[model samples]
Target: MASLLFYMSATVLFAQSTVAFNCSINPIYVDIHKRAVHGTDIFQYGSFIGVGTPAQNQSLWPSLSQNITSFASLSYCTNNSTTLKECTKSTGGFFDASTSDTFRELEDFNTLDNDRNGTFDGAYGRDNMHLYTHYFETDGASETRLTDVTIEIAQKGDIAPSIVGIGRESTVLDALYAQGLITGKTYALYIGHGFDRAKGAVNGSNVFGGYDSGRFTGEVHKYPMSPDTKNPMTVRVKDIIINDAAVPNGEVSLFDQAAFPDMKSTPTPFQAEITTDQYPLALPYQITQNFIKHLDAQKDNYWGDNSLKLKSQFNGSLSIVLDDGFTVTLPSEVLSNWSNITPIQDRDENSTSPNYLSTAFLGQIYLMADYEDHSFYLAEAVQKNNMVMPVSWCPKTGAPQAYQRPQQNAWIKQGLIGAVVGGILGGIGISVCAYCFIVAYLRKREEKKIEKDLERSKAAKIEQMEIEEAPEFEGPPKTPKTATPFFWKKRRS
Candidate 1:
């Protein structure tokens, strides 16, 4: 979710010992996408994919015809908020089939229909209509594709233009794995703290099959990735603490389920998932009200936008207790802050939901996910500008590989324990241990590689499987119909 289920680079210094993953990072842009006609065209808004073929709406973008990567003409669907009429103000864009030779349309439908809600909802409740399938891979990160991969084109109204899906089932990552572009099924992210003017222009990284160790410091807290891959990644939140004082568990829910009709109405201890897509730390209404009381914060308009703003004099930090016993304490700045809200479809621009909630969708925290082991690491982020970090792939744990036996390490074990106890070490003691750990790790790695190589050299002859002819891509039926909703127009809300 931190990678934008709907949703890193370079070798740099880390203040503490960290794990390096074998992943590749690419430079991505965030464009605001306003045309010159509005005189509001230049600022950038974050997007997973860069410029593609020109769309039908190319005329709207005065600069579209000049850009080489501009291949497809963007088409604007009818705005379903009021009437099913063509949208003139909507600025959303996507990869149009008429423009790209390698574009292959698969099926278009609501991907997040866990509750049979007849709508698509991200883990944090960001709703949109999606079209998914494979396409030719070019540009972006060189290591990203060895062949064609799947992509999800989102029509999220004005909230998000279009973003690449990095979820478990995303075929883009799958294509990378199937072609051996990456060693395993994994990706890493570093969502920076630059979503608003106060933080300024901040860039984050997205890596395939690994994570960059240089972006984070302190003891990394590793938690098992959720087995339910279809749903967004979720963690066990044991409790919430405000200023060293624990909040009553039954008093308020972790998130606002009212937006989700199928979900329970009562408060639950830990139902929240980690996400980089949503800005606020969304919470139940009751809990949010309670927190406001705790901060003794008064409501104020953010700029002239009149969005939810809190003027709090309290500066104490907030701590979250994970199911694994790891407690992460966030400073007041991150725990209590504001960002421009992504307006929802059919909702008043001035009345978009609260900016901060009990959801804990804070971007200041650093996270690392390992898809193979179905686990991820969490820690406070250490921000650096123009930073680039490389990833290293460690041997798989709890699972055996083609030429390697399953392996485990005390580093992870000790790291987990330390995180649980909040026993982060510093000074010479930590430095000495870090040195020893690196030395032992390198030695073990070299030894394993040599041993595996020797085994391959002495192995007997083996028979290879027969090759099969590739199947042709026959597009979906002209009138394919089913319970799953398909729309080139409006989302079935």
Candidate 2:
């Protein structure tokens, strides 16, 4: 059971169903096991089914059930566009409400089910995991959307603070390996450090409070009455899976981008865009945009199209949030020209690819999806424009919708190279076969012709002999003299 559960969790943890046709083998499912390690010494865990979507105030996600269904119905293609079914209840994008206290950070996440209990487990061990579907997309009431999608990830692990990380440092991998227990074992990975305040980005409603140190004090400790300010569990996931779903389609174009309040600045690379009600990093501030200029990364906060529509421009006041929970804002004229990024590739290229960037410079990037309100990516950290988790994104501009093979002069040239090679091979094969057949046929025919010619010559020679003998026999004199000897008696008489 444990092994099965673990496999299931791993499958969901890293899922990408939008690429493959098989619903069972999707990579979009994010299954997390929020287990508690028995006590402070150990941990316990639980299983969860989740859509690979991020949550925040005023944030939205696609209908997990609907999208999954629609994906299942479609014939899977590496180059195709998939439209999610309308949320019958909402009949629109899934606008997920902020699970995080973006608008109001609880003095104690303890009351907030802090122990990674998933459900109200432990002190509030109701042992229940919450299920939510929130999405927000602007369609003509109902319209098709184009976002790269496929499969789902299912995975299981102690997605909690079980094996305490000995220390804090980026370069401590070697040291941790030195500690056989730490290196040999594995763990789940969680991002976000607690803060005192939480609130929104527009006015300020995004913030949370917790100890600066990575410890789960609020939920895991014996003290329930205390706030949920415990350090976080550093989890290292075991497996990751994704389905490639980069269909061939024309991409969305960009028109304009502007922040309501024009600020004198450029789109900072690796910058964080925060939006909270009243707290630290709530307002859109220009931190460094760590994302690179031409590389693929998560939450790459650039002034590109947020609305995933063809010929549409991203006009929302959307900002980028970082993994550490920072945000980056866009000025009206900060971003222009959408040729920086290529078309959206398959899921694996966006997720597990070595070039895949880390967490968005901001906590999460803000982009647009079709029927889906917002799509998010939990990219790696320290990636310059590398790691990004967009609240939503589409290939409206810089990001293309399909892989672009270089333009050729004509259709014939499209696969000219391959065709040429194939033609050469075919010609050789035909020539060899024809040569052998013709050689055999000619050899037989030559023998028959030679026989006929020899017969004709022999007939001519025999005819000549008969004609020459007839001419010698034509003279009559030689026959009588020899015969007279027999009549000597008559002559004497």
Candidate 3:
């Protein structure tokens, strides 16, 4: 029999400021060799979370569910823009709300007003749904469950269906905080590679109020979270160093066109968000091309369909310099997905449209997010053969202090040669630096404007539903796409 771990009282003096509980990261199934009939990638991956009675008995929507057991991420009813059957069918999961005694309906709000009519669409087409469970648990340990233990359904949009709603305002996390189920609004993530284990199971880690230090090497590199609450995990990258060369040069443009035509080079000092939902780190084509060339990596095409991929048998590291003078270096093992060539169709059945397949997964990157103080920390991962639970983070202060390193100053000092600089150096040197900064700023600004324009233009078209109208299925209804529905929303970028 499994034992339940109760929450600690407020008066209890924890050894650490943050609390960490082992997470259950279930690997959904995928067929990497054959493409789906819906023009999706040959393979797709999603995480599994417990819902309904007997926790592990049912999986979440958009995940790989077997035995006809799973909960719908989005819910809906008759007379909606998308039929209930259509919504559930699209996600490739099995869900039946009518039979479950614990089923509860709520509003459905998707990533965007997918349809440009100034209205919102439910998950795929289904509205929000929740169920009661004896607290959430992964493996054997009990997880922090929100009120009603609800799970929002999402059948349509840019996000992967297998994700847990861990965003700043996600009702699930909010409820946990309101109920005093956690020490603070903090969490850590360690997404293990899917192909690493002999059984081919994912062993990723997620802890709600603290982190497990055993998952990372060296020390944590603390940085201020982005002030933009909408994009809290944003990181301002100063430059991308491949191996040892700062790429984006005219020479690297050759490989840029190999993946797609006119692959623009990404300028330095740009912003990127850390998204666990994606597998690849999203980089501009030009940078990707440079990454390919320097690493001697080749594009994969198992079916000879001119598939875009990053392939390399060699080893290398990609370093990201932040504006705050911190550096994050990722090993080739963490960045390479060459062996896995799953490509998801992003828009309008145009197989080559930009999508999650393009973004690089933060594999082996350990992350610590403190939502209460609006800060997060990151570190290079160190994989362990066995799980080790350290003492829970306990701090006497109101908020846990950030990590400090004695070598950080040395690293920044060496980086002063050409990296992020914001001071008055020798007269001529300062003048040249100022000139370069101005040019880079203007170029980055132009790119931002272009990206925004493209996003708006694409949002309308990509929001269209491909489901058959009045489709009949032996299951619950679809989430209503009404003019006004209040529910959870997240920015995936």
Candidate 4:
């Protein structure tokens, strides 16, 4: 009787373990919604997330520099704007602390600087955060909710969008992993070319704990995450090339002295951080000037963000070469459009500026970060299909591998065809051929079932075993007093 009871208890435990393991292994996918925000002429791409206890919905941009999720507080718009209409338009959406019953303020209103030229006055607090799979803010079919997640309510700051930070510190990803909602503390991003939806642009993808294999193409280049916690995702720019007719090869390197003899010095490879804070590829002043001169671009004073307007639209394409031999080419439309170009200011002979490969650059490549493994990968962006294959990055799995479709063996296909033809042509041994085919098919099916069962059994065993403690993540370093804060310059007219 004791042995029977033991067996029943073990079965119950195994069933519960399997259920928990399956839930943890599934990844959370957040789709980027293209909506007409008040300030911008072109449509913006952002994820619509719900915050607070009552679920105040807000369209927040995914920020790499920020450590916690931030919302424009009710005070921010009331103090900054003259009217309610302007407030809602400018702030994307605001959160009322009084309305949320679960909100608990941890820190009073204070100035917060993100080292990346982003200085804002905000109050730190803990609240319920919700991530939705649907693009619409109203819909909540498959929502992942976390209670008492750290958040910031911004009162006043530079013209910026409310952002959900996916940084190196204890971010939303970490919270999800800790709660066993996700398999690992990792995420992948594919900022689609959906800025102008009218012109065939599609919504971007932001997958937590895994990557959408269909979003990228070509060989994926891997790199170790930067030691600088402030800028974990950094890549070196080797050369900038433009398609030029006057040149012998119809391509001219911006760094080549022969091409631009007036250049004071030859530009060397420089590191740039990949961020989603803003659009435009922020390069060193020298490189920016070289690009401006080559393209005959002029400053758009109206924009007030150091945006360059092309005098005569450049018809040729522009290509950026990375240190790893990976190249990303931009079409003539991107080069001609003034809104797509911005120069890194305060960067000259003596001074240096924060070089960034911002949102615009992300539209052309796939970015995947494995915080646990301290590694990241980049691949050419592909939008050929909307197929999604989410690969889980469990603690046991370490790093999530990109999914590849299995190619069918030619021999198997040929053999099957030969068997069918032989059966039809020659009556002799027809029954034997049919029996063989049925046996092979049944064997393949049975093998698959066995493999799945084995995986489930292993997962249950792992769940039953004691889990090892993960290494502590290092905290962000203090921001320098002299460091300039970068702000989102987009504002309503």
Off by over 4 Å in 3: 1-48, 53-93, 107-145, 155-159, 195-202, 227-230, 244-266, 292-313, 324-326, 334-361, 390-493
Candidate 2 vs 4: which has more TM-score: 4
Best by lDDT: 4
Tens digits of per-residue lDDT, candidate 2, 1-493, equal 9999999987774454332212121111111122221112221121111112232111111111111111111121111232212112111111121231221212222331122211111111111112221111121111111122222111121111111111111111212223221211111122221111111121101100001111111111110111111211111111111111231231111111232123354333232221111111211122111111112223322222121111323222223333344333332111211422211212321232111112121222221111111112222222122111211111111111212245677646788877888999999999999999999999999999999999998789888863233322233335565575422222211
lDDT of 4 by residue, 1-493 (tens): 9999999999897666444444347788887765544223434456757788788777677777777778887667557533333345546567788989899999554423357545566788889988877734456547889888888887877655478788887468878888878877778887766553113366676888777777777788877788764668988999989887866999989889888898888999989888876566678888877787877776664434455666664678778899999998877666555454433222345555568887767877889887766788888877555476766654323334555667767866569778767778776677789989999999999999999999998888779864444545445546768886654353322
Q: Residue 358, candidate 2: how far off, in angstroms? A: 11
Q: What are the per-model numbers of colliding residue pairs?
A: 39, 172, 32, 4
At residue 462, give the lDDT of candidate 3: 68
Worst 10 residues of 3 by lDDT: 26-35
Report the number of the highest-TM-score candidate. Answer: 4
Which runs of model 2 end up more than 4 angstroms from their true locations? 1-110, 113-435, 458-462, 465-493
The count of backbone overlaps in candidate 2 is: 172
Off by over 4 Å in 4: 1-24, 35-44, 80-87, 108-113, 135-140, 196-200, 338-350, 395-493
Runs of candidate 1 with Cα error greater than 4 angstroms are: 1-41, 51-73, 77-94, 107-146, 154-158, 197-201, 228-231, 244-269, 284-286, 297-308, 311-314, 336-362, 394-493
lDDT by candidate, in order shown: 0.41, 0.23, 0.43, 0.71
| Candidate 1 weakest lDDT stretch, 10 residues | 59-68
In the order shown, the candidates' Cα RMSDs to the true structure are: 37.2, 22.5, 40.5, 36.5
Q: Considering summed lDDT, which 10 consecutive residues are worst modelled in model 2?
A: 203-212
The residue-by-residue lDDT of candidate 3 on 310-374, one tens digit each, is 54343445566667766665555544434633221112222332222112334546676766666
